[model samples]
Target chain A: MTATLPGIADIHHAATRLSGLIVETPLIESQELNKRFGGRILFKPETLQRTGSFKFRGAYNKLSSLTEEERSRGVVAFSSGNHAQGVAASAAMFGVKAIIAMPADAPAMKIANVRKMGAEVVHFDRVREDRMTVVRPYVEQGMVLVPPYDDPSIIAGQGTIGLELVRQAKALGASLDAVVIPCGGGGLSSGISIAVKDASPGTAVWGVEPEHFDDTRRSLAKGARVTNEPGHQSICDALLVAEPGAITFEINRKNLSGVVAVSDQATRQAMRDAMANLKLVVEPGGSVALAALSSGEIELAGKCVAVVLSGGNVDFGTYAEIMAAA
Target chain B: MTATLPGIADIHHAATRLSGLIVETPLIESQELNKRFGGRILFKPETLQRTGSFKFRGAYNKLSSLTEEERSRGVVAFSSGNHAQGVAASAAMFGVKAIIAMPADAPAMKIANVRKMGAEVVHFDRVREDRMTVVRPYVEQGMVLVPPYDDPSIIAGQGTIGLELVRQAKALGASLDAVVIPCGGGGLSSGISIAVKDASPGTAVWGVEPEHFDDTRRSLAKGARVTNEPGHQSICDALLVAEPGAITFEINRKNLSGVVAVSDQATRQAMRDAMANLKLVVEPGGSVALAALSSGEIELAGKCVAVVLSGGNVDFGTYAEIMAAA
Candidate 1:
């Protein structure tokens, strides 16, 4: 049976549910960036969101929808960092227990933050072990599983950002020609695509991925699901998903304008530029959409564009190294 | 002759003048910060302002109000970095010529950005040369002088942020107990003090300064203007004013709750914490208000507080050093 995807109405309901619960992150415009790119570029900075990522939107929406019995039983989730912290914080907000399965080599800061948020974490070697195996025991114990990007509720939740963006743009008396979003499992892109396309049918939605793991790009081009080769390396740990989710891929295939892939070096350069120009702390994964714009991979001259900075959960050591190199 | 300071009416007018010219920055709240401090804290991030600082507010207000003759003759201003960039950007926006007198040792990025914004920059020796001496020729040539923070229009412009905070807090269904603002020449603090005090008469307004540059704090305590001892060093170069402004001090003396001083070490730590928790890039001087709260110098435990992060024009080298040290 095919998985049902969340539509515009579900996203609208999610927007209502998320009011005051999640931050309505600002749509910021940079004059300097506009001059350089010759486009009116609006940045939807989820970096400023609670837990420093948009993952909080989905996590909170999903966790709050659970029945009283399910809330007491708790929830299990797996993420490298951003989603892990999102789940931990959201669970704590609803007074539910969260067991997070994270990779052994996940950023130390992310791991510490998850624990600080009162979540129990189980670490697994990403290279040698499957994350699901570690979380299976918790799921067997009747804890509900909160998938990072595959669930309909999660997609609808992230779509709330798109709703806010459309409303904010209109209030500013501006209209978007296109919107670029960082893609991992295609959840954020697909969700935003549906909402933005419905609100402003003229706006195109594009997904950006790291060069090393362009599974979503390949899948979108081929009109089928695709997987990345193992052992490929990238600094964008957050976008290291080997393939798009089954449900997410279907939605993205229908709604996305196209996909763009950016190099690790380009991502680093975009991070440095963001620090210098936007005064924002964005992770490498979160910088992909910006990288695509800055590198001219997406031509947006004289057009009104919106780029979503999906997260900012980088460690000091890694951030320093990147800034130092630049 | 005594100069007249702008009042609440002037600030409201400035708010109307700056409707689309300036960014109405968001008042951000962090759950992690609230948990650590045990109080609701609202952060007014002027770091996201046009020139990465609130200096733009004052500069734009002053520049936009110039007469046609003054605009044709152009304007001259002195600043270390933030104000220089702000003046340059505002001048460019109005198509007016700007001669910026900046310190030779100001961050290279700031110097380059001033030039990139189409301003003519004249470097001076911060230790041996008075900036006014270099700009005397321009003033003699009929160009108007724009003081960084001493003028009524400048202060009135900065007060627009205060108006926004009061309105935003009301919409959020919250009221502030106190507002802590970073002190440089007292322009931002004094201006915000006037607006916030008038809008929310019950809320207290406090000023924060770097430990080495506690002129404002000492002045408030002594009930008279005081100067910092020369040759003292601080990483908060933006707040290195030796003494508070003549007009600014008079206003602050009457309206301020008090002034608090934070060590450079505390400021650095706060910058790191801001990057980690808030995902915002704040400079040393800009982080002082948050530093006061983090160091427990402001006593914000159980009271709703608002802190202004005034700038984010730090260079990568300096930011990397701080991050590496942390």
Candidate 2:
């Protein structure tokens, strides 16, 4: 049986719960970007969030809601980097121990950052090992498992951003016609869609994915779950999910307008443009929504738009290569 | 005689004038940074400003206040990059033509950005030709000269940031103990100090500068105008002023608690730290105030402090070089 999904009411409760815990990241507008795109583009930069990503919102929401006994027992989770850091940082805040199973080939900076947040790391080979198997021992030891995108609490936590977006946009007297969000497991997109649709029913929600790993796009089109081909490679390490989460996919299917895919090259260009115009550091995954907009994949010439910059957890070597190519 | 220096009243008027024209750049707090520095550090990131710098505030304030006759004749100004873009963009908003005199050796990206804003550029040799000499023809033809930091209107415009800083901090329930601002000719520092001090009389306002070009520091100590030694060089190209501005110095001399100088190396490190932690692209000059705090030049162990990141208009080549060294 499928678990109960999060709704707008849950997101509002999460917002109240996370009032002082997480950063209310700014909704910034760039005049140069507006001039180039021919629309009023507002950027919800979660790159400036607590762990340099929006994953912190869900991680904190899930961990803080556990009972006293569960909190004392600690928690286990699997992620490449962003989710690992989010879980680790949230666990530390709640005075709970975190055991994170991460891919052995993950960016060194991300690995280092996760450890720096006081989490015990269990590395798994991405090609040879299943992350769930690697973390099964810890979960069996009475430690609760914290799923990255499948949990209702996690979805509700991420939905807080959607709520903030509506409030901030209204404060600026802007009525958005569409919102573009970067997608991995569809948790962020689904959560944001629920909140945005509830608050501004007239606004359309769009999800952007990396071209090579566009499982969500296929899933949405087919009206069912779809998996990506094995061994697909992309620079967007954060948005490399093989399939959308079961619970998140259900909500996204109902609320999302459509899903768009952007190429790696386009993502790189968006990163450069963000650095030059927005003065914000954006990782490949974080640049997908912007890439779609700048590459003309989504059309909103005269309308107001919002693009969510999901995260900024890139390494120096990767960042340098991107800047050099530009 | 120096023109009358702008006061709190003028800054309030400037805030009203610039209501929706300028970005209210986010005052962000990084939890990791707070942990490392052992204090609360709020960052006023003007790197996210309209022209990627806070210079836009003063430039817009000056241009929008010009008489109808003055607007018809257009405006002339000289700057390395940030101020040029600010002037060009602001003049364009008011439908006034702008002629900018820039150094021939300025960063190619900066020159290209200035041109992209539709301003007519006249190049001057920094060592041989005076900037004023290059723009004198335009000035003689009845075009108004928008001085970078010396005019009262310009100071009042920049002072609007100080007003925002006080309001944002109070909203967060944080009472700032000190505010460290980057200093060039003391326009930004003097303007912000007036607003900050008037609102929070107990807060200490400190000006930070490049180690070699510590003219403002020297001037503050001498109780009169003092010039830096000629031929001194630093990576902070935007802060190479030899002496403090005439009107700005009067406000700074009376309002600033003290001035501190940071090394080029420290500024570079701060830029790297900002990229890694804050996810903000900060230029060398913009990193000065942050440099002072990170390098222990400012004793802010237990205090709540605010550091203003003044600009982020660096070229890719220079930015890459700085990142590589880190």
Candidate 3:
């Protein structure tokens, strides 16, 4: 399975192909964060993306493979959040219709944003039945099914950030000791680890997961896919996937240096730090890498480190609530 | 006066010298804004600056020019907002002690931010007495007075953004029809107007000011400085300067093509639009250019336009108030 996966070269090609569609968001040095963490920390702010999330990169890449004739039929994706906006926005860019299947309990802000992007929203009860079941009809109706993760195109697209990180570091003449990536279904981590290792072999790549929902960490330790139906609650809903993808697990197991888990308190504090210091509005899922740094889950004594902020799709009200909660 | 004044060439040299002290924020293309304005619009997001404002550039540039003997004696500035943070942060970088004189009525968030930057804060009763009266002694005692926008170094540093806009536009092989710049003390507008006109003579530079504080507009029309009382009401405190600086007014009047004024309503709406569409938290002063666009005060029919978002130093509690007002 590891041998079957595409490496850094494939990801680099995807990045070049998807150039103008995705923004090369600013990689900023955090002066406040450096002092707080006792070492230098650079942030790759994907919150400033076209759809306010790095999901746009993977979504755009997946849609670019479709022929004009196929695009006319449109695309369908099952996400109540960032991926929905990404798919809808990428489809809109292509002048194609997008249908989004969302949970009945999806945030109003998320639904409004998806509709604003010209996507037709179809609601389903995720607790009662599988959302994918509702998405099948759209696929059968000649619509392409855009998976949020667990797809090669998505993984390869995310790996592009890893290539960008290495290039950015070289451009700034900053040598990184580590690059911390947040792990959800592991598509981003798997892809980024491969590219980071390939581009800077001496730089270690660490995956950070919420302590409560540490599926990737467990999966890697067990050397197999593991499910977490055990009610371990995490505020980071975006990174609460039940298990790691089979393809992604194989890549992460071999490529990632290690996996680190941070407490929910650490995640919330990191979110506050990001807003106050970095002037970024990162969702809890996106701030997991920073959480790892703050909690000493990853040592940053004398080394420069870069953290990928996965997305900024948190609703403003949700952010207010999270800050209040913190 | 024009022959004696420094133009784009001198400003360009200053821009090159001050590059590392400032963040080269993105001049992003806004699809939503283009659809509304019937033309392309580039948003230069200076909200992502070191102190959440472009003032850092000017502050750092001024501090960098101090003699070794003077640097050890320290620096002082009279500001209750972004300028205080800028001076404090920049001086701290150079290991210089900074004493900031702030109004007692200044927002707690701003005061806290300045204090966190490791500067000594001195409270002044702006309601009872003049802040400049207190600043005079500090300057007399050999402490440098870093005027918010009335100094040469400050204007030269801000002109760098205009230089960046030209380079960024040329890189894309696109030419700007007009560049919209926000005016407070006219430092940003005056410097930018010279740079833009010199680099691309075809591009017209327009200055935007809040209607409530139209001293700059009045002064330009009267051919003399028009001083308003400190009570001129404006949500944009950063732009509530009593009058345009002498040097800034002379250059702006000679170089700027036009001046546009927008209401507080328009400014608030622009802030909402930035949050909702661009996922940015721009302060009131920062959103004035967008306000001018949305209010139809500045026409952009089929033209490529750029607007500088001067800063994003708004307090979180006040953000809700601004949105509610909108």
Candidate 4:
């Protein structure tokens, strides 16, 4: 049986709930990028979002949806970085306590930012332990789990980007030919896809993933949820999810035109180009959509495309290292 | 005789002329910065402006001011980096050729960007050959000189930021107590100062400069124009101008409340902090006003302040090295 998924109505409701609580990051475009692509290229920079990523939309929505009694018990979240920061900051905003389970090797800045927000952090060896296993105890203790991309509320929350972008693109006199988003568990991708499809049905929505970790792509290929082999790796720590969340996968499969995977090298080059041309500091995962465009994975000539820069939470040393490489 | 300088009406006219030609770059603020300063801090990031700096406003204004016959003869500009890129891009936009005199040691990216816009570049030894000497031949050949900051049109063009920020701040429900600008030849500072003082008389407009290159600060102190010593140095390549322009200095002396000088170390720290918290790629010169806030050069306790990030054209290698340093 097909389960009911969050739709445009839920997304609109979430937008209302998130009004003034989240930053409606401006849709930006560079003249050079537009000229290079031979088309209008619009960027919705969620890098400028609260917590430096789009995760704040879902985090704040989830927090707002919590019962007052449930909030007292606190929220538990499993994240690589951006989601942890979002939950921590959102919880702090609402006077709710947050506990985040993060990989030990997550970028130092992300971890420090989470701690700075007064959240309790539990570190797990990403190679050895599953984040779900780490958050089980907190769940058993009556804390609401704000899964990164699984819940309907989170999906609906992240879908707000799709709503804002369509309107913003219209305001800027651009009718997008397609929209591309970076994918991990497909929460942000699927959420945005659904809204984009609903608002502008002619526009195509595609998901991009790292070459080494293409669970979402493979899942779409196989017509079902699939897990990645244990040894795959990439610098996009935030997008290393082994598989797409079941709820997000179903929506993504229905709404997304297709899924494409890109190389770390390509993503790195796009990050550098963004620094040089767009004046934005995009993280590895957040840059994958832009990578897809720059790497010529998708044909952009004569077509206006909107690419979402999902997050910017890379540590200084790591970012420096990326930019320094030839 | 007192010279008739550009005023609010001139700025309003320029804004009208530049209606759709420029990017109305959003004013950004960081919640983390607000907490650190114990007050609201807004950032007008002209780093995202076309050509990656606020210079575009002035450059485009100058380009638009040329008569049809004058436009056919093309334009010439002398700059450290940002102004050259702006003039190049603006000239290209107007379908006119440009000849730029740039410092030999200007950031590679800036020079490349100017050439990319189909402008001719002539490099001069910044330590020996004065930029005026470099551009004198072009002006003599009948190319209209677009002096970086000295022209009345340029100051009025830069003053557009003051109009935008004050309106944006009020829309965000913030009443700014002060506005800080990164100063070079004082065009942006003095221009913004006039507008802010005109629109919000109670608001204090301040100019920030590198410790060793604070010509505007010294000029204000001595009640006349002053020049920096040749041996003094800083990493703010875009802001190494030795003296304020005649027109700009006059406006600055009348409008600005005060000027402050910050150390390179402070500017570097602000650049790093902006990358981490605001997810922005700020160049050395673009970061000075923000540096003034972070370095505690000015007290921000219980007052709302606005800082303008003037440019972002630092090469990736240089930026990476800055981020790598302690």
* Ranking of predictions according to DockQ: 1, 4, 2, 3
lDDT of 3 by residue, A176-217 (tens): 899999998888888888888897788888899999678888
**Per-residue CA lDDT of candidate 2, range B1-326, in tens?**
54487889989998888898888988888877898999999999999888889999999989878888888999999998888989998988888899999989777777888888889998988767877798999999999999989899999999998999999999889999999999998889999999999999889999999997999899889899898887777988788776899998988988898898999999999999899999999999999999999666677888899999999988887887787776
Query: What is the lDDT, from 0 to 100, of the residue B29 in candidate 2?
Result: 83
Q: Rank order by lDDT, top first?
A: 1, 4, 2, 3
Better of 2 and 4 by DockQ: 4
Interface RMSD of each: 0.7, 1.0, 2.8, 1.1
Docking class of 2: medium
Candidate 1, A206-319: lDDT as tens digits: 999999799998987788888998988898989989799998998888888889999999999999989998999999999999999976667788889999999999999999
Winner of 1 and 3 under DockQ: 1
Worst 10 residues of 4 chain B by lDDT: B1-10
> Candidate 1: misplaced stretches above 4 Å?
A1-3, B1-3
TM-score of each: 0.98, 0.98, 0.94, 0.98
Q: What digit string (tens of lDDT, one per residue) describes model 4 on residues B1-326? A: 14658999989988998888888989887888889999889989898999999999999998888897898898999888899998998898889979999888989999989999999999999999977888898889889999999888898899999999989999899999999999999999988987899999899899999998999999999999889988988999988987998889888898888888999999999999889878899999999999998766576999999999998899988999998884
DockQ of 4: 0.81
Q: Which lDDT tens digits does candidate 2 get at residues A144-246? A: 9999898899999999999999999999999989999999998899999999999999899999999878998999899999999897788898888879999
* Candidate 3, position B266, lDDT: 86
Pairs that collide, model 4: none
RMSD after CA superposition, every candidate? 1.2, 1.3, 2.3, 1.1
- Please give, for residues A66-125, the per-residue lDDT of candidate 4 as tens digits: 889989899999898999999999899889889999999999989999999999999999
